[model samples]
Target: MIQPQQQSFNQKIEVSNNFGIEVYVKREDVLHNEISGNKFRKLKYNLLEAQKLGFVKLLTFGGAYSNHIAAVAAAGKEFGFETIGVIRGDELVDKYLENPTLKKASENGMQFEFVTRTQYRDKNNATFLNQLEEKFGDFYLIPEGGTNDLAVKGCKEILTDNDKMFDFICCAVGTGGTISGIINSSYEHQKVLGFPALKGDFLFQDIQKYAENGQWNLVTDYHFGGYAKINDELKQFMKQFFKKYLITLDPVYTSKLFFGVINLISKGYFKPNSKILIIHTGGLQGLQSNIAEI
Candidate 1:
């Protein structure tokens, strides 16, 4: 892990005087430009473990615009390890250079193997993994979203003693890793709320696999249609939020999360005087395409 010179801090968000709740955002985004937020937490120990195991190369999986792919590529470049991204969509094989995320990863010295979406769906299959092994030789395999036991272990370190004052901890969920880690580290007095970026019932079960306790709940109302899907209202909300807070929220995750939490506050979802802390798991690099639209 490349420790930042300055650590993440909690910054309070000013909401309407009508609501009696206090909301603060943990600026995990400031940790590192590329390895910011939960990606840093998720990959910290995974990279160390890979190096400890004497692996010279690392392989992971993600889509063309996945934050995990970008982070892994940057990490590999900085740490002197070869990175391989088994990208989804064989159609992108020739045109991946057009994609900001993939282009950035490639520039960081990461190699890519484009596969069909169907093949990506079955990426965990033993046969396919064996084929990758035959092709790329030995490498440390980090899962799609960089979620694993080590990743969870790294995530557990996100919370500090200063966070104990909050009554509720909130974060955007993707593949269940970040929330699970937060759930494990949460104090008994705090409730963990996850705003999933994608709509799916499988998340609960996946979260259950790693969460050490049951104090977490998924807020399914704010996915904004589904993963990577955006709308005019959400775009406006994000724009207004940045204008008001001077903080940029990525359209894919943090924007929806902040929108949900604030909307819920307006609806009286949180108890009066409750303290809320929202985890800002950064993926601002993925916002490159949405910036022009916003």
Candidate 2:
């Protein structure tokens, strides 16, 4: 098994004194250029288990510009496992070359199985699994966003003894695996806040399945429309944020998370001298899809 490296220690983000909060980000995005951020964390143990179980191929599901898909493809290539991406949107199959994320995954040797949106929603259905098994032969399946028990186990490692000082832990929520791990590992006094990139409260239930404690809450106001949805205001904020922090936040996750944290700070929601640690879950590849817009 190839062990993943630990993330860098606190990289402080400068904030105004009026906010009375100290913000620091754990640089999980730089953990690896390809398999970076929570994607790496979620996949770390999944890959090990797959290899141990004697699985030769790994199959997963994702959208057109999913960082999970790209990370899996890169990890599979590096670790010697055949990878298959059950991508949503059948139209993407013919336009892979035009889509940077899909093109990169293909370059890394990930086979594509483009399914319609309706079919993609059945990704977790038993019938879907049976069909995939018959079509692709014996393979280990990792769910979309890689949020199984093993994936959450890997994500729990994102925080360490050094992070216990923070009063609040923040992360962007997608399928909820990453924040669930954070919630499980956070200090007793730490309140973990999740900013969902999608516009919905359903993630609260999804997270409940894995979180071991009640020290977490979902801040659903900063999705900027919905999943993979963005606007001019969000683009401008991202540009200003990058210019100030020298850190690039992908529109899909980290951007929304940062935006939420800052908004909360501005509203004095957090008490004075509060220490906040934000998890930078990487989805940088999603930026390529919006290059023309931003």
Candidate 3:
């Protein structure tokens, strides 16, 4: 909530007339430096609730290059709360300094506890959470992808009345929270499309939990391989995209989402003169780790 008054605007992307589609990007990345894009939306109310409950510390889970981890750390530093990140992959315990994201989080005063992948999977296990509470004393828990009722509530504000002009509302889905909020806030005529970064059948059920209506659909063909997986095609696309639009897309999420939307347009998925609005949920900080590839 550093710049709570900031509002994101939609900038139109130049699409070919042959495709019969109009693409616009919601520049949520400019909302803040650390808590950029959907991270700020997801954490807004959670942070307020934590403070209301008299908690001075916040705990969350993520991987080595997680945007959520970095954002949580930055929020903790800026908002005056102690922060802890339970990082996946215990091997990173000794080499975290080599990672830009982890190093930045550490600099922001986030304490880290590296756990193996198996242990990290138990993040929601009652006994595991109890153990963390026992060790950390007391802290407000934010989930791995920062998805929850409050998070969906905050995300609901991503769209405004002006956004209703678009026929399709699109965004990159992480844990389904952002899309759920969009689904709820969307006009009944608008089709909420989510391009997921991960591959799984569970996401449908996960999204169904918070979504109030059935106006949304997931486009799963564009994950590249899976979460955090990238190839030369994606890297080249990112480079060419930046060269053309001057918009830097994160390898993990936004890049794939944009790619999918463009591909769909080329395939005649959208009708003539369809206005598609895509959300830019920033994860650009992750470029530091994958810079060599791009």
Candidate 4:
């Protein structure tokens, strides 16, 4: 099993503007090299629990260029557990030639098993697990997006004991597990904010089901087009922001929502002098993979 490493606490909060919002960022971006960002926080306990449960092999689901798959493969190699990736679509045999994420996963020694788009759609169905067993034998299967109770447990630990209480906290919502964990970890006085990247079909309702107390808000306009989709404005903002602040934001998850937070603050939507904390879920490896296209 892969052992978890010590987390580093870096950077500090400062007043960058006169908007009265005390914006602070938790640098989850620098968690590790290959095992970077939110993936580490989400995967830490899952790996540990899998090991504790006597699981020798780890199985998880992801797409052709999934950050979760990349992290799982690297973590499995680092922890000595055999890793298998149940990839979406039956194009694995033809994808490695051009798919950067899959290429990196192979370099990390992860075995790939392809499933049809139809089969991958029903991840919770018994037939999927049966097919996995028939192909690669028994293994601990992690849900796609890494949103599990164990993942929530690990993410809640992101907030250390020394953090000052804030009136509100904000983060991007992908699988809703991290948001659920943040809501669980925060005090009653504080409110949790979720900016959703996936839209349509009552997304916040699902997130609310995971979070206790049902006190969360979604900044729905920031998703741009969809998951991993970006435009000129987002790319320009990312470049300029990095140039000015030396902090990087990936187009898929963190950057767009953070942009929304700042936009709202600038528009005077948030009350003056509000203390806000933004969680930086990391995906630079995936960003790097898209350098040419970006």
- List TM-scores for all candidates, in order: 0.97, 0.96, 0.96, 0.92
User: Model 1: per-residue lDDT, tens digit, 1-294?
Assistant: 456535899999988846588999999998888776888899999999998999999999998888999999999988889999999999999999999999999999999999998998888999999999999999999999999999999889889999999999999998889999999999999999999988888899999999998488999999888888999999899899999999999989899999999999999999999999999988998788762110
User: Can you give the lDDT of residue 287 in candidate 3?
Assistant: 90
- Write model 2 residue lDDT over 1-294, tens digit each, in one string: 666555456799997768578999998888888887888889999999999999999999988788889999999998999999999899887788798988999999999999999998999899998999999999999998899999899999999999989999999988999999999999899999999988889999999999998599999899888877888888888999999999998877888889889888989999899999999977788888772110
List candidate 4 segments past 4 Å from native. 1-6, 10-16, 291-294
Clashing pairs in 1: none
**lDDT by residue for model 4 (52-115), tens:** 8888888889888788888989998888789998888896677674888888888998998888
lDDT of each residue in 1-294, candidate 3, tens digit only: 345436788898896668567889999998888887999999999999999999999999999888999999999999999999999999999999999999999999999999999999999999999999999989999998899999999999999999989999999998999999999999988999999888886899999999998488999999988888999999999998999999999998999999999889888998888899999988799899872110
User: For candidate 3, which ten residues in a row score worst on lDDT?
Assistant: 285-294
Model 4: lowest-lDDT 10 consecutive positions: 285-294
Counted clashes in each candidate structure: 0, 0, 0, 1
As a TM-score, model 4 comes out at: 0.92
List candidate 3 stretches off by more than 4 Å. 1-5, 291-294
Please tell me which predicted candidate would have the highest TM-score against the true structure.
1
lDDT of each: 0.90, 0.88, 0.90, 0.78
Screening candidate 2 with a backbone cut-off below 3 angstroms (N, C-alpha, C), the clashing residue pairs are: none
Better model by TM-score: candidate 1 vs candidate 3: 1
Looking at candidate 2, the ten consecutive residues that score lowest on lDDT are 285-294
